[model samples]
Target chain A: MDRAVFFISDHTGITAEALGRSLLSQFPDFRFERTTLPFVDTEVKLRAACQRIQASQRDSGQAPLVFSSLANAGLRTLLMASGAVVFDVFEGHIERLETALGLQSAQAVGRAHGFHAQGRERIEALKFALDTDDGLRADAYGAADIILVGVSRSGKTPACLYLSLQYGVAAANYPLAEEELERVELPRTLRAWRDKLFGLTLAPERLHLLREERRPGSRYAALPQCRREIQAAAALFQTAGIPCLDTSNMSVEEIATTVLHRSALKRLRW
Target chain B: MDRAVFFISDHTGITAEALGRSLLSQFPDFRFERTTLPFVDTEVKLRAACQRIQASQRDSGQAPLVFSSLANAGLRTLLMASGAVVFDVFEGHIERLETALGLQSAQAVGRAHGFHAQGRERIEALKFALDTDDGLRADAYGAADIILVGVSRSGKTPACLYLSLQYGVAAANYPLAEEELERVELPRTLRAWRDKLFGLTLAPERLHLLREERRPGSRYAALPQCRREIQAAAALFQTAGIPCLDTSNMSVEEIATTVLHRSALKRLRW
Candidate 1:
């Protein structure tokens, strides 16, 4: 028999229930039952939740676990019946956060992580603009509060795109060409926006990981060129003092947030 | 001094690091410093990571709070020298899973969530076929391997979209119309694909929470309608014996996973 799981919560039970239900997808054999107590915000609700868990177990003829993000104190106790295990995602994280931050647990219940990703809106808009592939201009740098400059696989586009989406920052990025590197000078348009510019560089191995996704096994994926280009880019960012952040170890989200936080720019939110 | 929160991991640092980075974006005032020990397989790597943390403390003024997820044996000693409070995402999860499963700790050192969402390929292909104003299809109940039938604002679209993006599943959903509820008989097309079809229902409150995103205030947005629609639709699902999943407190991911798991269908890659 497939083991059953139940998801219960304090309010609007849909979302709280969903958080636990989603975990079931990973374990295909497990079955799920969800109950959302939206009307009652009292101890009675918790008792009701516990009763539902008991009923599900009795009906299913299996020990179905309950995963809840309960808000009310009564609800938490009601969910504590011993027929099956309970994994409370909300309370677990709330307790962890309290310990981590040296504070009391959160007053409310439910998953805390349902926010829009930072910089996503701005990233999407900028991606829309850059897809036009227009050349750099005087006003382009001015319109863009921050500019990302780097070699092809050094993680410019995705990082900039993430920034725009999560923080709503109008980020623009231009690739550093071989000639531009040879000249070793910022573009005339970017010279004025130097303080706002950020550079991304990566180790050869990471650049290779990225390039493999694009062209597979081409000269563009060559390690030597990757090393040389990364070195040149790092030198340029260092000399230019452009607040370069290496994308070698950072994920797409991490790289984007690092740039935004470091720049001390107002977070762009919708 | 602004708080310095660090997210570090031993394996697949990219993913673990990305999740942590997303969490940090919630706080704008904090000075976030992100560093990753991408492949902390050997003791040498562990020692080096420890040294870096020490160097960071001595170099920076603030005591960096480390959020680490390490699966290896030697990291505790290395991190002990850093003299900062730490919270590991996987430490508790690992302990619980081990005890529950009666298995030794896998010590899986990364955020490795496998792909288990159902129905993306058909949906993406439908995106190619999309030319409707009422959403995806007039005959959606006919063609879907799993048709998500729900009342409006019941999280059908996002669940379908997530199925399309994450698991490569071809998910289609049809809104429960007033006329359809009155009939409550399965639509002719739905009867043909009854085995493949599933119902998505949510608590009235959850339905309201979801609808709040699109239209805030109106008689259409009142609780009575929400309660009436949910009860009617759920009763309809019950009479039909169509497997129904409630989506109130759930995320898009949870809904999709629940359907895929319950249906025992292969999940598509998003």
Candidate 2:
């Protein structure tokens, strides 16, 4: 039978979904329908969530699996007995933590991604990332926490976006165009931000494939062109002593983490 | 003393961090030093993780809080016995799930956000989001799963971006410039894709505040101008019979969720 998986949370259900997916991924053979019930911070909403779970169980003729990060003890206890297989994503751990540390968890609600408390800062950071994306607004460099420099399709854009969305870092990326690639020195605009400059590089084969997807059979997509550009970019970054990361096999999360770690750039600690 | 909190995972530790932070945020009075350790897929890595936890305990002279989403049972057992306050982010749930479902989880590793299996698709979607942002490439609308429309700073860009990054949705956003807002009708390019079009509106005060940050005291940032633009934009959206969402007082996650639900757009389904 196809199973139902619910990710329920008092705030943004991102955490419940993430942890639940990691576990459910292990059981890939089973067919599953996933639902997210976020901001279930009220008793009324919790009742509706329970009704949905009970309905899923009735419709599927099997117990539905629930992964919850609900912080309210009363709601959690209510959810646990809601006729579904409940997975308290945080309760057991919180209890253990409370005991080991001789402290009690405050069980606060909706602070993870509330955004309202610090919405202006995060919104500005996100705007900064979008406005300065792909070197669109070079004049704004003075406000950037760090600037990512790379050849086209070296994974600069997504890395910047991830850093902004996940860490509230004001990241801007500058593409090393053909002229800059052929030059040994860093671009004129980047020289002023030398300390804040970071580079992203990738394998020639990967670059060729990524470019080919956009412009099939073009000179830009040729393996030789990719190789020469990467070599030039690498040399330029090396001579300039700019920190670089190879994003050929790394996910955006990994690239962002590595860049932040290597540069020690300050994140707007959300 | 500041408490140490570690978000441990077999993959990108993002899940552990998100949920852990949500739970920990409740205890606002306590100071915390957060650390994320991803890709703990081996015994060696687990041992090193234990060492880190042990050292934290020793340095702080207090039990360190660990939130883990590691899927391997053997490794989880080893981690539980580590010298920290262990929070099994997934185990108790997984065990109960197995018993209730009458099936065994595959215990596979690195499946949540494992870009290796689907990186190309996600990268393409992200690139699409960037290229089509702010109506840059209008011709590419045919390729988009959904198009977001609203005046500048109406929360369209970030919502589009979040949809792309999190769910691999090919979301394109267009600004309702003065010309379009004054016309009282959807733009020519958008009229063709009416079914794919979604609208984002925000409170005039919020828009004024957001725009003022970028360009202080300009017409674009004036409260009166914002009020007029938003009124015209909302009227246009309403007259055109297009569905719209108000982004005021809502997080980007909430806006994205509401948009996806209202439009029933197909998510890339990662």
Candidate 3:
């Protein structure tokens, strides 16, 4: 059986879509027909959305589902009159929060994507990630939220970028150089910040494949070299008691999420 | 007046918040209290969300707005019974799309955030962004989807990074050197691929302030120098007819969106 789903909002409707996709994923047996009606701040657009929902309900013999983030009372009333199942994204809860916090929301549109303090902070974090990427700027450890230590091509750069990009985290990554690995001790620059360190390791085969793309036929890309480095990096992480995740089978999203959870890092508000 | 808003989902509820925030912002006269109930896959969680919504309605004398993307029919039914306004984000629309395309959705959960072919493509784009940043690999320009040209502190790096991180665009950026800027022409290497080039210009004052932070008191941070560079860059863009946007007073989101839209670049499905 097929049902219609609508994501209605005054802006991009990106948020509605994200939440809708997630919720809808749980029902693996049913098929959904999805459409987004963004920039629906006007009464006409709201009525159009209502018509679409009603048409779907009529055609399919099921109540059409609506995922809406509408903030206007008049529009909400208009949507409700459609007689389709509606999910109001913000109505009842905003009142509770306002009462509890003793403050009124700005009731402004696109504030989530607008330029503000948090957005500035995120931009700064991205610049920090770029500046401190790949073990650059050794003196800037004091400013880092967390530092990732790993061997070459073990997926340090993307992991750090993801943390900053997704969470406004000021992440720095250091490549464990061969000389430092031979000594089998944490680098002098990182010793003071060991508490802030997380390690990344990749499978030998994966590491070899990634390295070969960058410096093919070099010792760095050789399978044996990858194995030795992986072993050494793992030993360093274990001996130092630094929390680590194997990136061999993990996406950057998974790695960044795990690292943040393990580190107990607080994500900046979205 | 204050109202309650709920972002209900079986996953992160991020989308509900985004679309919800955007929609509510348009009605700046009304204040909203907000809550998010994610992972509402179980009947228990769904009921908990309902109780919260009902309680808010009881207290506030207004129904809470619900932005949901529930895929499961049973869960959707359970949520609808709460007597709150509901928005079915996927059900009504997926069927329409399936009908139009003559295919059924996979009906999988977490498809938006899950690792798939798109994920691999994004990863590759990110790697490309890192490799091609700051005009390091001119020989690899052919691999780029778009190449951003700008002077230092004109915001090319962050723009490229945003394109790759959010949209999976293989964006490369070139920082026009002082010598090249004096020449008042696109660099020899870039001329061949002029069509792929996009220019970024920053406000003189903003550029000056930004440059001063890195190279304090240097000529590059001087107002006159900043003005000169901005003029030269704008002139170059005009002569070459390369599309450009001012980075000053624009968030990275705004810049990236404009560039992608103006350039007719395709954003990968997230």
TM-score of each: 0.48, 0.88, 0.73
CAPRI quality band, candidate 2: medium
Candidate 3 residue-wise lDDT at A203: 88
lDDT of 3 by residue, B1-270 (tens): 766778787654555556555545544555567666655768888898899999998998877877776666678888888988765555455564445435566655433443343566778999888889898898999999999999988888878887887678999999988888888888998989998999999889999999899899998799999999999888888888998898787667667767876787866644
Please identify model 2 stretches exceeding 4 Å from their true place. A97-116, A136-142, A183-185, A191-195, A235-243, A262-267, B41-51, B100-116
TM-score of chain A of each: 0.60, 0.89, 0.78
Give the per-residue lDDT of model 1 (tens digit) for B170-261: 67777788777778777665676777767888788866765665588866677787888888888888888888998655645456667777
The DockQ scores of all candidates, in the order shown, are 0.08, 0.52, 0.21
Residue B253 lDDT in candidate 3? 63
lDDT of 1: 0.58
Residue B121 local lDDT, model 1: 42
| C-alpha lDDT score of every prediction, in listed order | 0.58, 0.82, 0.76
Estimate the Cα RMSD of every predicted model relative to the unseen true structure: 10.4, 3.1, 6.9
Docking class of 3: incorrect
The predicted structure with the larger lDDT, 1 or 2, is 2
Using TM-score as the measure, name the better of candidate 1 and candidate 3. 3
Model 1: which docking level applies? incorrect
